[model samples]
Target: MATQPLIRSDHLFDTVELSKWELEQIMERAAFWEKNWRPGQAPFAGRFAANLFFEPSTRTRFSFEIAEKKLGLHVLNVNMEESSTTKGESLCDTVKTLSALGVEVVTVRHREPEAIQELLTEDTGCKIINAGAGKMAHPTQALLDLYTMKKHFGSLSGLKVAMIGDIKHSRVVRSNCWALGKFGVQVIFSGPESMRDHELEKIASYLPFEEAIREADVVMMLRVQLERHHEQLFVSAGEYFKNYGLSIERFQTMKPDAIIMHPGPVNRNVEISDELVEHPRSKIFAQKTNGVFIRMAVLERALGGVQR
Candidate 1:
């Protein structure tokens, strides 16, 4: 397959604008790139990118580093706490300095979803990719998850996916809904009433815990964020787990071919029981592995125009 032009999602109405065929092409390219990867191809050999992460991440951050190095881009990983932002330098100022340094893209993970939009509208010359921003979006995570699903199921068209837990606070949920909905997958939201988002009314069906699990082809669990938890969200973790958590019995309720997925670091015995997470049907590890390949595709597509 010939390499196509890098198309930024910001120009479109939503990331879902990419057709299913186009998405398949990207994933196929990603698989080929991962299998026959060369170290010094230097797709971004002369370019630079900034990894500005306000929130701590292990999988997403390292995956971006791996992707950048694979494409031979010089990566400047900015530590938010150690930077002048802590000293009252605004995000715009930090972005300006980085842009002036000739960075081609700024991949950021912040607590506010509007941060990425603000950077784009502020006239910073750099292209913006939202690694994760607030509970609004985690495009990369959704992409990786879709890549994994495609690799495993071969197609997404008729798959029944039940996204369980913390829908309101999970950027993963928002992104997955958009991506999966684009592929015509039936996304079912299963969580406490407080975590349910009415906005998802357009794309997903809200289902109760046990009913959603029954006959599901994929059960994607979102982390119950302790840090984001408040007294109003739930009475306690125990109550949350009892209502929405995937227990061993619940695992049996799914179709025999159904798989379980979690964007880790998983809260074992909370959002998902340890027994269910380590079961044969679990795709959690595969999801993590797919992150590298998917990010490789994203980086290459985002900055592959530069010659070595």
Candidate 2:
């Protein structure tokens, strides 16, 4: 009897589905790829991927571009604002057009996760990667966070990680909770009560203010996006900071080995104090660097490994 191939989800819902061994394999592969980048070694040679970003991105967009190039794939960056979608083309029409163009993977960042799901259901053969989708998921961010934590501590199990600020409107929070929880980390979701998602009870423990930062091994701060305020999700920036922001005084509450992380662009003096952002314990910069390695791993995995 022949063994069946492992069926992985095109949409990375959570990291839990990947076994510990598989996670390690991905990390190891990522580290190796980072150390030894070979020119013209495109596992995706002759293939094309369309970057369909409906929202703004810096790290994710550039990282994917770098990853695809390293793997030898042609990248078609679709500026949604300049596309016919702005002129009233339906999402299905846009996706269909891209699919018809022979793109192999569709990596997208949108305000809605369901939009990606809909595209996947509509397009039978193309692979769909969610770069980010409104407060829903950022799998690559989570992967890089895990890689960063693993590189620092050597493992994620039993680490006390506090996710600070803007839980309600953060895709990073949602993805991290699921990813870190799978590794047996104790995750604390900290923010103003208004920004706390009532639906996150299963994967994280919710806390308010300084209590969440106390003695944690990692304190991950998230930017308080100003757009959320227009939706009435937050009362005011000052009030939000007072309740859950990582002020310098509050930063003193963390364990000595605890590291600070933030997915940039940080709203310094708002979500995190400037001093802490530059402090020795901050791994924000390291996380950004790891973004490239993790993205390389994702592209390699999704594109079927490095080819000669």
Candidate 3:
């Protein structure tokens, strides 16, 4: 990749929009913050952040809430069920209301990728962070995943990552491709043929699942995302696992130092085995743990750190 100019946006919506240096800065800051974070530090003191999640989430939403609280920022968590959207209010009105409430930054996770972007204006007066946006991008998740890999290996260059399962509907995979590529990590895809994204193929290579696994330093499994697909991508769940899932027996074939990873709510015995969730090499839980620190870094950066 060619050297790119510094990113000029305060909002983080897509990994591909950020320069490699910006991503590195966030990862390094997260690592430093994780090691040195202290209570009442208040990097984002006197600022207000709102977490508006239209979609269901476990880690991303809670982690941002925790990060905001830890940073001593005023935090408002909007439950969409109770919001005016239930009364037919538009996303624009909800944001306008938050802006009127003096929010300094907003983090959103909506079903439509473009919904959040459409809310931006010349004088919106608040930073925007993309938590998860459709199947298009989940920039924060990819950032934390990169941070996890960097934490383990100390560098990302020369690493090979095999992304397995439900590639077409996975925002995690989409974001990781752009973020990981910036670090010079080799990324390959594997899944049921019906689940492969044609757009992804223009930039990435496909290999047999087993072959991809054996050669990778990290095997990152994605959720099946059956909720988004109307058609059966595979013949059956058992058959999918049998042909494409990560089993203990197959894990034994991987490099001794290679790691297993999953962005959670894992489908045990489907994309990965149950025991592997707690396996020595599994970084799944660690990814969730790192999410808070990474989010803190993002929040601070978005709000202009402690200086503002």
* Candidate 2 ranges with C-alpha deviation above 4 Å: 1-22, 230-236
Single out the weakest 10-residue window by summed lDDT for candidate 1.
5-14
What lDDT does each candidate get? 0.79, 0.78, 0.87
**Candidate 1 lDDT (Cα, 0 to 1):** 0.79
**In model 2, what lDDT does residue 219 have?**
91
Q: Identify the candidate with maximal TM-score.
A: 3
What residue runs in model 1 are displaced by over 4 Å at the alpha carbon?
1-22, 39-41, 304-308
Write model 2 residue lDDT over 64-178, tens digit each, in one string.
8988888778999998889999899887678778778887677888887787768767753567778987877888898889999998998788899888777888888877777
TM-score of each candidate?
A: 0.90, 0.89, 0.94
The sequence of per-residue lDDT tens digits that candidate 1 reaches over residues 170-277 is 878877877887788988988888777788856788888899899579999889876676657877778878878898888888888999999888988889998877
Candidate 3 segments whose C-alpha is farther than 4 A from its true place: 1-9
Question: What residue pairs clash in candidate 3, if any at all?
Answer: none
At residue 27, candidate 3 shows an lDDT of 76
Worst 10 residues of 2 by lDDT: 1-10
Candidate 3 local lDDT, residue 32: 70
